[model samples]
Target: MEVKIMEGGPNDPACPLMVDSSQVTQISEGDERDVVQSLVEIIERIGSYGDYRRTQRKECFNLVRRMKLLAPLLEEVGEMERPLPEEAIACFCKLKKAFMSAKKLLRTCHDGSKIYLALESESVAGRFHSVNEKLNFALDDMPYELLGISDEVKEQVELMCLQLRRSKRRTDTQDIELAMDTMVVFSKKDDRNADSAILERLANKLELHTVPELRAESIVVRKLIKERSGQNSETTQQIIDLLNKFKKIAGIEENQGYGIDNVFLPKSLEKSPSLLIPNDFLCPITLEIMTDPVIIATGQTYERSSIQKWLESGHRTCPKTRLTLSHLSLAPNYALRNLISLWCEKYNVELPKKENTSLGSEGSSEHKEEISAVVRDLSSHLEAQRAAVIKIRLLSKENPDNRVLIAREGAIPHLIGLLSYPESKIQENAVTSLLNLSLDEGNKRLIAKAEAIPAIIEVLRRGSMEARENSAAALFSLSTVDENKVTIGSLNGIPPLVDLLREGTIRGKKDAATALFNLSLNQANKLRAVKTGAIPPLLQLLQDKNLGMVDEALSILSLLAMIPEGHGVIGQQSFIQTLVELIKEGTPKNKECAVALLLDLGLTNSFHILAALQFGVYEHLIELVQSGNNRAQRKASSLLQHMSKCEQVP
Candidate 1:
């Protein structure tokens, strides 16, 4: 069972190292500070993994010590008031990737199978060495002088680097001995020839003495094999086979042992280990695996792009918690991200690349020039104008910078003119281009201020379905500004939007509903919408579950109920009956909306209250008051109080 101890060189955790210079992509300087801070936070969490991986304690200690030295420097740079020099930022970006790799390795040590890990000690040690070398590589190239760091801290960093350079060439001898013992125990041809004493010692060390522990570690090993993306099938199968041998040695029967510890750290991690897709891995909105999960203030994680879109659409509450977020800031969830990355690796799932959402930040000089040329073509002949607008549409949707460049290139007025073109293609591309451009927050006011609202409204009234959809979307995005809401309402925008909401395709209807919702926020526009036959279709949408818009319809009706005319229109017996039914049979949000609408209706119309009372609405109201959410309970109580005030009539 004797084996020679290996020296640390290429696989040495103590070797001085440098990351490949080419892997250092230029990160946006504006984001580098936050990224550094995030790295610091993740490293802090990684420090806690020392409690596990007793076999790899030496490697874990080395990793934690190096990170402890790196954290202060990271925080110092993150807190610098002056802009970080481009060289330092580049170095930090490279370090960001390296630090994330270190984190993944550390997480594996904590979550992976102890027996499999013990058998693969050299590989695990090599991984630790790799991360350390990357760290050394990053720090060695870092420009400490240009970083504006204090001399005392600079010397400490220099010492840390020197420590890595002088690291004694040695591997954990205990891990080496354990691996030899395991191999000798398993390599024997006969049970009598194998060393049971050595096997017993290995099992205790691997924490496989109990049936449940052996079974759990086996599950962990299988999970590791599945998640170890890009590994050859032969290698994965070998690891799985080794795991089964250990389980057989431990005398545990399949399906008889207790599985993953029921005491999971978070509710998000409590899914059965056998499930291919963990429930928490999915974005609540998209219901797909999240590529870039972020934590909202409510401590709920969601796909970053999805939640950003939700915030942009003017929703201020957490999607799952339904509580108003204290602030709009989204913190990166490094723990969840590592967990998801592991899950994706196990399944060999290729996650989508992280998109650069901060457009115009990249070195997009070529895009700027090309977009300028394209914007000029908007004034060319019909064919050229159509071609130019198509290019502009793509450019505008691609980045915020393109939208800025397009506006500056004099494409806005040209696009506004094309919005009225008799040619449906040009009109569709033009309105759609404007719709794409309006995604930029600054462009919202620019688009509305350029006298484009009137033309956009006209397109909403008569263009093709796609054009009308985009027109409605543009109006909705633009109407975020208070002045644009008035401008749109004054230009008779509400009628066309209401028309689209009633008659358009699904996307068109969604766009129209959103625009009408935004426009209806204005007191004057609410009357405009209610008077233009918007009520009938909105009410009709209540019973149509397939539209998934009962809440939207109720929201609009609630706003209109503030006015006498809209309230009278919505006070019809059928709509009140529908709201009552929803109170008894809807989702939590549906019940809340239904209660609010009924409360709104009864504030001025005693007949509506009498109608609801006739339907036995009191029982539902009492139930909601006792068990519904805060909003629903308050609204329901108010409805009951209002109903109680109404006197008997002959």
Candidate 2:
């Protein structure tokens, strides 16, 4: 069979190629000659320099490069002198589509500059790259027996595809080199003295150059000193003298200037005899180290007590930055507090503990009495109970210690009882208080043991949005305990959570997703969640632009995918493409979850392997295998291997 390129002007009626019904019908009638000739003509047209010169030069270059590689494989099929199989005919149709799309894109480019610009556009480049990959696969992935091609022709096509891949890799390498060259030029012009100084300090602190030699000498000196001490004091002194002489001879400095003396010595022993504190670690109002640091809306940290006093005095501006306070809420600076504590521990200094208002100075009895007073007020008439609930919520918000105190005062029972009240506001406040109190593990157990799950579930199902949000939050906190997971799941918790996920506001959706995430940790709950229609809402949540929500949604879906029935349901949705997108564009945690979900689906059903490939997951998984973290790499590798086995089975 042979094909000839059609010669015609750009304005000719049939200027561009077309794959019509008659051509397919001809191939189906066992007319191998017509099919092969048509394919050859298309290949010739793709490679002709005269035809390419009339279109965009750059687009034509790429299209020709791809078509040139594919031409030989198609020609090999033509040389087989047999009718095209159904699969081969399908492959040809895809090739024709690629050809037509590329031609149309090229024809739209008006001039040389437009051609260059269009080729440089990422979207255009990506589309062309995808087309090329598809063509490569169409030729390389066909089964030889189905195509009636001899082994020699199959080997030739495979080798040509392999060479094309190597060429593509070289192009990628060149691109990386260009990027690195640009970055190097910018880096050389940038100021980086501070970064260099920090690196130098880190090197000195680690003793990267001197520690090994010091360790070697210290071992010998310690042994000699120990052996001589038993003989006599004089001999021990002589041994120490010998060690000092050896140290001098070896040019070992007595102090390596680690600053340990300054760090370890008490303030009384220091030469300056004053305590030193980092400026960032002290509150501006008192000029004292912050014990309970909190950040205001202006992004300045202050000791909570000092800031409270300032706010109470009607100062509505930050002391350091002098910015107006937009809101009165203070978020705890936990990371800063941790750093301060670590600094104190390194220098053997005691950190002063900050006391909460709810705790007494003396002991547990005084604390118990204070908590009892609050709870008593909460159990009173409506106004007083509301005030007490607000007070307890505020106290619980201050610190975990207050929460422990409130829980010990039997506040869980009272809070749960308030959930059944007629007033929605009171129910919301009660649940909010419970949410805060449940942060303590002990309180979680106590709340669950007090049969608070039923009331929380009731609030979740029937209360206002705020109440439902808080109830879900409390359930999430409680479900952190393994036993409480079963308790919540058994009390018909899955359906309400799904409802919240489906119809709630953004915040409500996040809270519901979080609760479902925790509940899905239990295997029984995962199965129950599937039966309760959890996957559809979870899939909806997966599209959220919030990374946290997407992460939580993917996590719950991954767990649900472990169930066989759940796998079938998830696979039914057009979710594989979304999962693949996440793999390419999501955060590290999101990618990890996405990869796990895909791997689970692939393992559960062999048919899913083909779906994964159709969604272009292989490239992402291969990239993960090369560059992802340990767990992601492991799962991606396993999935790839599984897909490979599925392909080989037939």
Tens-digit per-residue lDDT, 574-624, candidate 1: 888898899999988789879977877787878999998887788999999
Query: Model 1 reaches what TM-score against the true structure?
Result: 0.46
Worst 10 residues of 2 by lDDT: 172-181
C-alpha lDDT of residue 190 in model 2? 32
Error of 1 at 487 (Å): 0.9
lDDT of 2 by residue, 1-650 (tens): 21112333334434223334444444544444455466567667545434332223454565566566556667777777556665566456555555655554554332222212221333444445555665565565466688766677677667756755654332211122122112222223232221121122222222212323323334444444454555655534433433332232222223223221232223323554355667677665544467789999999888887676556433466755567989878899999999988987776666556747332123445555767798998779989898888888877863545677788777889888999998999899899888888766568788888899999999999999989987887887777678989999999988999999999987778678767876887989989999999999888877867524776677678768878878989986389888888899888767877887787787778877787687788888889989886557666867877787886422
Return the number of clashes found in candidate 1: 4
TM values, all candidates: 0.46, 0.47
**Clashing pairs in model 1?**
18-137, 226-346, 227-345, 227-346
- In model 1, the Cα lDDT at residue 170 comes to 30
